[model samples]
Target: MGPLLDDARARGRTVVALSEYGITRVSRPVDINRALRRAGLLEVHTQDGMEYLDPGASRAFAVADHQLAHVYVRRAEDLAATRAALDGLPGLAELLDDEGKKAHGLDHPRAGELVAVAEPDAWFTYYYWLHDDRAPDFARLVDIHRKPGYDPAELFLDPVDPYVRVKAATALARKKLGMRYRMAVVPLDPSPVRGSHGRLPDRDEDGPVLICSRPDTVPGRVAATDVKSLLLRLAGLDGS
Candidate 1:
């Protein structure tokens, strides 16, 4: 990597290093959907002893994403009640309504009716089932699209499952043999997830970063939204 950078420098090419966001250590996993379900706002359907979220039939539900969640309410009248239901929920730092969404630039039509932000050292989970035995088949597997929310637990193997590694190896062998396989090794527990990011960083050092080889084209500080314009400027395509 150093040699490549040196070669680029020798060729008079500009280099830029950037990151979308920085992850911070987290210990708490906020069961946001479970909270909504406990309040009777979220609904689920049972199939073969497994529970799956029924968004269409539900009054309200939460889509957890890292340290934040988007709460979708089916009815306008349920908005206040939904907010009240989330009150005192552990690790929930803030709940954003219409005014709050507008202030945060999250008032788009596609945005959820309410946005939930987790505490600094916490993250939101999509687990809606009250019991592990009733969890959906995909809960123990890394099925990103089917989960209905971002799951950091997908990064780990089931720590309590003694045969998790063996099953994973078997799945890999089956895949290599061009056979159907299910890599159901991911954990249902979110406690092992030690890092997450989504909420605004309390300090600048904890946020995203941008570094440019051409000092003249770089600003003293850069916001995440300004990165694109800065890149265009660096590429001499912005007519700046």
Candidate 2:
């Protein structure tokens, strides 16, 4: 917890947020209107003008047109907008900060950074659609989705790993000009062991992905992903 927070703080972020809020906050609403669309691994949308979805976000939930879904917040302007929308809640900032320290640890760089700029509130609501296995079932993506007339219902969805994307987000915010935040989750594969010059440590209060320093994350493993890659991929630079 201490190290991960140290890492995040060293870089900077608002707080270590879980992809859970960004992904599944309001996805599985008690009311869902299925049969909206198909064939989209990702569905991007806007709710009250906020970016709502990106790659790995679900389409089965008909997120393409749903006003309830959410998307990853990348840019500072966008993040600021989000923080604004979340106003009205009291102590959200402190709670997040204390929780952050508790979550990331007292000395994580990422946590330190997040505490520096964290707000007192984060809008909360119901969105269950975000939790429907954001991670792809490699087998299904390769076999079932490729097969003719694959049944969406029959297709096996990989369990959601909200931390992977959130961790990446924290890392990206770290490289930002001034975003202090940390993310709590089980670190992604291709651990920093081989990438970060061996800064690998154990779990923190944030649920694994303990911060340390700039990860020397290897080029491949899925867990090795960071915000730079995720954002660039969103910008259509995956092939590069």
Candidate 3:
């Protein structure tokens, strides 16, 4: 990539490099769905001894993603009750309602009724089951689509399982032989995850970065949303 960038610069081609956000260190994992379930707002269904979230039947449930979560309330009447139930939850920073969502530019039809932000040192987890034994089969595997929310724990092998590596190797071998395999080696614990993003960075140095090949073409600061227009202008396609 470095050589390619140098080559592009030598060729006088305009280049723009950017990132969505920077990850920060996080230690606290907030069990948002568990809290809602305990509050009688979240509902789950049992299938073959494993519990899965039933969003349709649930009065309220949270879809956690890194340091943020969207709390979907089934009915407007249950909004106050759901909000009250989440009160005093540890690692929670703030709850965004209608006005708050508008202020944050999150007021969309698909967005949840309530949005939750976590503290600087904390993050939200997708774990809902109280016990590991009753967890869904996909909970231990790297099955992203099956899970309701983002799970950084999928990046790691289960450290608690002594034979996790062996099992993973075996699963790969089985797949190579054209046999059915389930790579159920991901850990249920979220403590191993040390970094996450999604919340606004407290420091500018910890935020996203944008680098332009031609320094004169870009301002000293760039807004996240303005990147598209800036790129278009740089490419001479914005009708400047």
Q: Which candidate has the top score in lDDT?
A: 3
Local distance difference test scores for all models: 0.92, 0.30, 0.93
- Ten contiguous residues minimizing lDDT sum, candidate 1: 216-225
Q: Rank the candidates by TM-score, best first.
A: 1, 3, 2
Across 112-191, the per-residue lDDT of candidate 1 in tens digits comes to: 89999999999999999999999999998889899989888889999999999999999999999999999998888888
The whole-model C-alpha lDDT of candidate 3 against the native structure comes to 0.93
1 against 2, candidate with superior TM-score: 1
Q: Candidate 2 overall Cα lDDT vs. reference? A: 0.30
Listed in order, each prediction's TM-score against the native is 0.98, 0.19, 0.97
What residue pairs are clashing in model 1? Answer: none
Q: Give candidate 2 misplaced runs (Cα > 4 Å).
A: 1-52, 55-72, 89-240
Candidates ranked, most accurate by lDDT first:
3, 1, 2
Greater TM-score among 1 and 3 belongs to: 1
Q: What are the runs in model 1 whose C-alpha is more than 4 Å off?
A: none
Tell how far residue 77 is off in model 3, in angstroms: 1.0
What TM value does model 3 have?
0.97
